[model samples]
Target chain A: MMNQTKFEELCASFALGALDDNEKQELLRELEESRPEQLETLKSYMDTAEHLPAGVEQTDPPEHIRAAIFKEIGAAPATEQQQDEATPPRQIAPPAWIRAAAVFLAAVCLVLLYFTLNLNSERIELAETVEQQRFEILDLRDRVQVAERYLEIIGSRNTYLVSMDGLEPSPSGFGRVFYDPESRAAILQVANLPASPPDKDYQLWVIREGTPVSAGLFSLDVDDQKRYFVLEDFFEEDFEGVDAVAITLEPEGGVPQPTGDMFLLGSPS
Target chain B: MFILFALLKKLTGDAQEEAELLIAVAGKDQQALGRLYDLYKRLLFSLCVSILKDRHEAEELLQEIFVQVWQKAAAYNPEKGTAYTWLVSLTRNRAIDRIRSKSWKNQQITDSDPDNKILELIPTEGSNPLHVTVAKQRSTMIQQFLNKIPDEQRSVLTAAYFEGFSQSEIADQTGLPLGTVKSRMRQGLLKLKEMLSGKEDQI
Candidate 1:
């Protein structure tokens, strides 16, 4: 036991935060060893010395302080403006919806004409079958090319690879991917996806073995950005034999086995 | 010493959070810098006022502090001291430098309020007011802790805290032996800490 009086004096000094570093340490050490009462006493003082009563609000910060903070945030580097100037002007000749409707009408007319011609050419069935098979092959080839380009992007250091395949609702719309592997940790992007319902959202999953693990949930913001939904993290090698990457429209937090329709799937190639 | 170590650990832990914020500021996230400013503004402002004694000069010094904080956030090393200690030291140094600068000779201190010198900050008056309130509360606690010390000892502490003076400088100003001033200052702080601890338990 050290002198209680001296210890109390030290505690007072400590609460005021006046002691030098070494002196503070020594006093606290002595208080800890010899006097449990002083230790408890000092704890109270420090605690009270750190608390504040309620209703002590700052009425207002000077408006100029607020302005300076905003100005600093908005002062983008001049290089950003230069970069914006380098882009070519966009041509806005016709509305996109009107152009889409015109294309749809033209397609309808072409399909009707094909059906009439096919009805007349009943004797040439073999040639028609061969042509149909050739067209199917061409479509498959295009899909592979698209998938390859997506893989190239995924391999970049900036993106994490996420795989999702069909599970429940709309099982056939399989094999969608999401990636966001950059320092910015940006928003998710989806690729090779089909249209989803207005009330539903497309959730990305990192499947491990037989389980559907949610990487993140995302929806398309614009038509131009396409099916690419930026996701959180990639499915590392731990997800071996992941049955298929699946997307389920769950009530936000996503589900274990995918409660909603499995909109898409991508098996390891 | 053990208790002091624990106390330092608690305070410094908070500093680490600020250091992380500083890192965010270096990335030019103005909001993070604003949060940092909000965290330390009161103590920093008080410290400036304590030395400069002019609100306007202190306000200008506050702007200079942030500018330096922005420019040098990358250089701060957590290993040197807690973020709070580092920041307070920085603010003190800047205020001392401002006082000593050639500009001080040209401008005379007037009776007019310095609130007019407040800098224009960001426009969005943020959502989290609680953080600033908590910091202010903590400063009040620290102030109360200072009040418990004897007047003679309190004067020495006030000089050290406000003017950023060394022990020898304090001794020279007060006409006391350097050793006597140092010991009294040391003893005064120890006693204040004890009183604060006892007062805290009563609550």
Candidate 2:
């Protein structure tokens, strides 16, 4: 007889389905003659071994695999036929009152269907209206934010406003630059500028000492009803010396250097 | 005592339902076969994929196993084991057999490294919440138990149970001695049984 330790070892392997043929036979013999407690222990081991796959994610086989399998086994059509045979036959020749009731129900169904179709169209229209209103609200919120910042800059005691004279590109154009020394915040508002060319943009540059730093690039909507194009977030960095602010018409995506004609220039007084 | 009785009743009820289905399947009731296929397909498919590491082959084997279930339902003996255990064992055995075949061996060589392959095949999407919760809880409990065992022993146990690797095969794959693999598997199972028995005592 195998020792208890060796027998348990074989049982564990047997539970794991890892024992070879010889060891399997030996384990089978032991299991056949084992006491109840020993059998329970082996069963527990098998139970735990079975649960090892519980950690693995459960995946459904492809939906058609079931159908394919049924087809292969010639069971799909047979099941359908069995189901049909098992179903009771439909009733025919209803009474007069029942026919009248059926006609009334059909009329009610038609009315409900008509209302449902109408309600669906109305709901779609309502959804479109809501979406449009949401976009309008968002646009209004953005404009209000810009107006609030503009008012703050104009109202600040420390802010200095500099006016720019129209230059060669557009003599009728005018611009204003607002700077707050304390907050180092600036905003630019330009008016009456000619519409930029399709391939060109209006670039703002701030001269700090001698070298000019590019502020940003923008293009105006000539067709817009608003007269002033307010450029928020004009300059992020603080420049110490008070100098000139200039606008140049350059190719789309402003050049590193001012490679185009200056459209507006203003030097702080 | 009532709770114990209720639990036993539920288990027996489920087994009875399965037994009836199998009987119908044995009598060539195609609908009963389909019903049986739907009932166990997910669990069996997951087990097959974990061993085979290929969804296509796992699905093919799944169909073949169900066909066998249809043909061999009459051979099932309720006195020997529960229907769930019998079905799971049949799937695992067939999957292991397929992996041991010559063509499968050659395919394994051309495939990616076994270590990089997903050892546990969990679905990433669209699983039922209740099923997911239950699976998670069971998996977490199993992981906690596995954590108690030593690393080498745990690896051998996992290779044998999840990958269906035999003791000698685990030794070959891990480059460990066959005796070491055997000892580790035995120690791992003992530790798991002890832990589970402790839990049962608490309950």
Check candidate 2 and list the clashing pairs.
Answer: A57-B122
Q: What is the C-alpha lDDT of each candidate?
A: 0.54, 0.71
* Candidate that scores best on DockQ: 2
Among all windows of 10 consecutive residues in model 1 chain A, the one with the lowest summed lDDT is A49-58
For model 2, what is the alpha-carbon lDDT of residue A89? Answer: 31
Tell me the spans in candidate 1 whose CA falls farther than 4 Å from its real position.
A1-61, A69-269, B1-16, B102-134, B199-203
Runs with alpha carbons beyond 4 Å of true place in candidate 2: A28-36, A77-269, B1-5, B102-150, B194-203
Over B1-203, each residue of candidate 1 has an lDDT whose tens digit, in order, gives: 56656644554455556767777767775556666776666666666776777778877777667776777778665443335545665666577657657443243223231211110111112211122123444445455666766888777766655555655677788899866666675566566546545543221
Tens digit per residue, CA lDDT, model 1, A1-269? 55665555455444434344455556645753644455555544433322311112223234365445445546433222332342212123456888899899999989998997887687488778889999999987876765665565566665434444444544444444534344223233344455544655667665666667776666544432345333334543443465556556665544555677556666544
